[model samples]
Target chain A: MLIKSLAAEWLKMRKSYIWSILAALPAVSILIGTANYYANKSVLTNGWYSLWTQVSLFYGEFFLPVLIAICCAYLCRLEHFNKNWYQVMTAPVSRSAIFISKLAIAGIMMLIVQAFFLLLYFCAGKVLGLASPFPIETVGWMSRGLYASIAISAVQLALSIRIRSFAVPIGISICAAFIGLGMYVMKLGMFYPYSLLTIGIGALSQESLTIAENGLFLAMNSLFIVIVSAIAIRYLSKRDVVA
Target chain B: MNAIVSTHNLSKRYGDAYRVNEVNLEVHEGEVYGFLGPNGAGKSTTLKMLLGLVKPSSGKVVVFGKEFDKNRLSILRQTGSLIESPSYYGHLTGLENMRIMQRLHDVPDKNVCEALKIVRLENHKDKKAGLYSLGMKQRLGIAMALIAFPKLLILDEPTNGLDPAGIGEIRELIKSLPQRYGITVLLSSHLLSEIEQIATSVGIISDGKLLFQGSMEALQSKSQPRIAIKTVDNETAHVLLYRQGFHSVIEDDALIVKEMNDEQTAFANRMLVQAGIDVIRIEERRKSLERIFLELTGKEKSL
Candidate 1:
């Protein structure tokens, strides 16, 4: 059932010009990273994680989360148009299945977008004559960053589904990113959902954080994903499909 | 005959007001049922509840002898519907829209071509649905509804915003659906004439209440007969008709003479000739469905 719903949600997102936005992110990120690397080659070492931090800020912080929110919101908004919500609600599938299918697709897309960012970062590092360093930490940081994206996706997807407006949820997710910078400055990053991307990825790269720090960051993100997603699915199930 | 869909004391209330109040409805298998109501008359809301789209504040919907919410998947597998506007992924082709819907319903093979053929949209199957004309859009909508081979089909205002030809085509398509597929259909429309011509049975609603529900023949039988008379002598015709105890009102060049039987109208026609006035035409005017609707809903002030 989820497979079918995922296919349907994917079709809806693909038809709504989401692909162009997804494709554009890595292209732009790569271009900006390449230029920065070339101008600062003397000061830079052959560090994959360092290069990722430079490139993925453009891809991850600003583009990736907003893209996930847009996709989820657009998936629901398409139904909102012309009362297509009526059709979906009347279908034989369970409402929870419908919500999960959309959530899964958003998660999949988030992973794919992160993969593109990682691939571009690797290519940019090589082109700028940087050698690999702390390969294990680099891999660890990338995996944690990507996993944190899924957690972030849960919160954004819920926001988009509940709010019913594509612009508002995307706008809110972007604003949350900026607000996360303040939390990071205050050293309270582990408390907020938005700070998961930074803290999870930061712990892997900093190499100095205690095991306790890593556990706390990971736990906060996983808890946020579980609790917020449960609330969202429950909220969506109770509310009538109004489209 | 077993009812494919049934509702008992079904009510939907928004706060203190009931959108549909204590409504009991039944649609037997293989029948064409028409739901007639004006705007805000709760026709759409009733359909929504029956389809399990909206949760009723209080009521039980028994579909196919099983509770609707309990057996929703099994019951819905045999149901098709077009509600409000037919919306699709605007960028997707008409065929793609049907294909995706079929996928969602878990139908293995692609039925896009077949659905398009049913709606006479075969040639336009590859075109984006958004680019189709309004009538074409409606046909595509119907096609989508029927694609799953549902046993019970529901259509809400299916002919809205269509030209005369489009309306006729939809009416013909709806009329033939029951016999062709051996399926039951519950269609809602505000156009009385269209429903009168096509529906086997109708349920009329007004102000969140069911006014009447019965066969089309029964509704027609309750309507009064009217005769339209036209004369060149407009002033004399009014004075002479009024004086003869026939209450007649002028409609353009014709005077619609109400409250008079066929014999009385014939007698009035002879009196006009005897009075040296030429009767242009005197024909029996079939009582319109609109008239029946108005009378049933108590909108008519008098006969």
Candidate 2:
């Protein structure tokens, strides 16, 4: 059932702007980051780390949350816009399967987006002639970023599913991303799911997280996904889709 | 004919008002059950409960002789429905939309093609659903519902947005369904005429309650024909007709003598004239489905 649900979701999305979004956002970040790297090439000592610093800042601060929000919103848009909720809910499949299948697909799509961003980052570094060895640390940071995105996807998915309007969820994403930024500035990013992205990526600020802080980061991401996913499932279970 | 669907004292309330009262419904196999009501008469709500789109506030639904609440998925697997409006992915083509439903039902590609052909949408199967007109979309919705070869079909106002010719085509198709596929259908509509020609059984509802539920013949039998007599001496004709063991009233400029046939029509005309009250006109008028539907719902003022 999950496989069927996933297949249908993928087919529906493929016919829409999903691919363009996955490719476009990361490509934009890379191009902008490459331009920034060239402008400050004279003062930079370490090439890969400097490049990571410039690009990931934009990726973490602005693009990442919005990307997750748009994907999540777009994921629910077909059912919402087409008013197919009642049709879908009346199907033989369980709502839990439907909700989780969407969640699983969102996680997978975001993972692919993350992989694309990483590849773009590497290619952009080579294009800048930053021939230094790959800073394997950035891979660690992006893996952490993936965990944080799961957390955002869970809650954002819940919001997208609960609300029918397209722009509302994306609007919430923009405003919440700024709050995440504020929390990060206060060194309180560990408590907020949206803030976990920048903190996890080791972008925005250079201070290294203590091992204890790192454990907290992993725990928070796991906790948010579990709790928010539970809430989303509960919402779906109780939802009386009138469409 | 075994009962394929039965609801027991089902009801749905919002706040203090009843959207659907404690009404029981029975639909038999090999039946095209026409669910009829006027607008805002809880026709849609009743169908929604049967489809499991909205949970009932009280009572339960039984489909295929089992508890529907416990066997929801299995029951749904055998049931296909279109509630209120057509649902489609505008980005998908007509064939693609049918294909998606086939995937959900785990059916073959041939099912999609055949279902489209049934609705005559196979010609435009490649067109995007967004561009399809309302009638086309409605046909496509029926195609999707029919794709799985479901044992039972629940169509809510399926003929809502169709031309007269399209409506007649759909009527013929529905009339052929029980014999062609042996599919039992529960279809709801506010327009009595829409269902009158196709429904084997009719369930009439109004104001959150079931007013009448029986075979179409049984319902039509409820409409009593009367003798329509108009005379120059109206009051004298009234008194003279009453003297002959007939009760008559004036309706639409004619004297309406209830429950009378051809013999009585002639008898009343003779009686009125013999009493020096000349009869101007006398005719037997049988009530139409429209009249019975209006009277059944207590909205007789409506056509």
Best by lDDT: 2
Which number leads on TM-score? 2
Model 1: pairs clashing at backbone N, Cα or C within 3 Å? A46-A131, A83-A243
Report interface Cα RMSD per prediction. Answer: 1.7, 1.2
lDDT tens digits by residue: candidate 2, B1-303: 799999999999989999899989999999999999889889888888887778899989999998987888899889989988898999999988877777677788888888999999989999999999999999999998898889999999999999999999999999899999999999999888888988999999999999999999999897777778898978777778888889889888888888886787777777778888877888878888887888889987654
Q: Mind giving the per-residue lDDT tens digits that candidate 1 earns over A69-149?
A: 676777677776766777677777777777778768777777677677667666676776665543555556667776777
Question: For candidate 1, what is the lDDT?
Answer: 0.78
The CA lDDT of each predicted structure is 0.78, 0.87
Q: Which DockQ-derived CAPRI band holds candidate 1? A: medium
Clashes of 2: 0
**For every candidate, what share of the true interface contacts is present?**
0.62, 0.53
Model 2, span A164-186: residue lDDT tens: 88889999999999999999889
